[model samples]
Target: MSNTSNFRDAFRQAKTQALVGPNVIANALPYVGGGLVLTALGSYGGLGVLRTNPELFLPTFFGAIVLQLILFFVSQNVAEKGNNKVALPLLATYSLLTGYTLSGLIFVALKNQGVGIQGIGLAALGCGVTFIAARQIGSNLSEQDGMALTKTINLGVIALVAVLVVQLLFSAFGVYTPNWLEIAISGLGVFLFVGASVVDFYILPRTYKDDQYLPAALSMYLTYINLFVFILRLLIALNGRD
Candidate 1:
């Protein structure tokens, strides 16, 4: 009788954890959505400000980056300690700062070519496709599959960083890339970031602990932001081509 009772208790505990795990991603959706709205507002707001005080753009852009880095590291530290109280606030602030920086880029693009609406539309479409793919992939992720995806994502990120570094070095040497190469790089960036968002969303529920929802949300938010930036860039590149 005692053996049966222990087995039942263990099963209940396992079931509870399993149930709680998926809610992490579900709960994160609202935060990610909120961040997106904030991004749009910040972009518009930054553009408005830039019209009057263009000199502030560089300082504001770099300031947002520094602030975001600080908030991100602090949020991660608190989340690691399971302190949602501190982590949630930090995450919110970080999201806003990220939006501010993104807004600066949008402002630049708008000033250059007035492609704001089209750029946003393209980003939305990319996000929609990425979300659908992620949902399909996440629904069927076993533990082994999740681990394999994680490894692939890590490798992909490393390769992407290396490629970017090479490009930057070439630029430093005043080496000009062909137009085709620029377009290809822009397209590849969009593809990579979209794939990253899918992987992040797919593994989020399986990977994060119960109290680590903030960190999970942060990861997803960053993925989405990167996806938006890359998609927007790809759109602009194609527009320029035409």
Candidate 2:
């Protein structure tokens, strides 16, 4: 029984590595394509749309989350087939669509501030830098430390959800005031999500190798998107009027 269990573990790891190569390709293409298209739209067409209907922004926000969930389930189902070639393309397409949906951020920022997009840039920079740092630190941690980091990441998600719930409640009540409390909550959220991103990156290449490519790509994709949104909200919380 011990030998059998060991063999299964070895097989799973090998499968995950096989998927990694194709997953990386599928993952990169969507980001590049969707990014270019959205950048153009936001830099040009997005402005007019937001001006005409500000409500559209709500759909973009909600839609991204919904689509993200859908893709997650789909990826899981694809993983069961033991063939990543087809799954890679689906993941890439999902990434592009997600990019298109997120373009609304550009319109929202421009409408708030007159042609300035510093908030968006800052958000991106914060996420990128934090992700890089977390990855390096995660790589260096001892096995025991790594396990502790995993616990931290999980707890961070719970804390993040709690914060989101409170924020939503405040917003719904029409008293969404920005205070030190809110600032602290948002700051903690940023840290948690950044930590989660690093943990996800670390786990992807090793544990989920069965459809390693899709899972890894999906993990990072989710991380980047969450990081971006969190940074944007942090900017709004810090700088926007109450």
RMSD to the true structure for each prediction, in A, is 9.1, 7.5
Per-residue lDDT of model 1, residues 90-118, tens digit only: 77777667767777667646654636576
Top TM-score: which candidate number?
Answer: 1
Model 2, 11-86: lDDT tens digits are: 3443332224424434443543444344344335434545676677567657655875576567546844555776
Cα error, residue 170 of model 1, in Å, equals 5.4
Which residue ranges in model 1 land beyond 4 Å of their true spot?
1-20, 111-114, 142-144, 166-178
TM values, all candidates: 0.80, 0.69
* TM-score of candidate 1 to 2 decimals: 0.80
Clashing residue pairs in all predictions, respectively, total 0, 3
Off by over 4 Å in 2: 1-48, 51-68, 80-83, 100-105, 173-179
What lDDT does model 2 reach?
A: 0.56
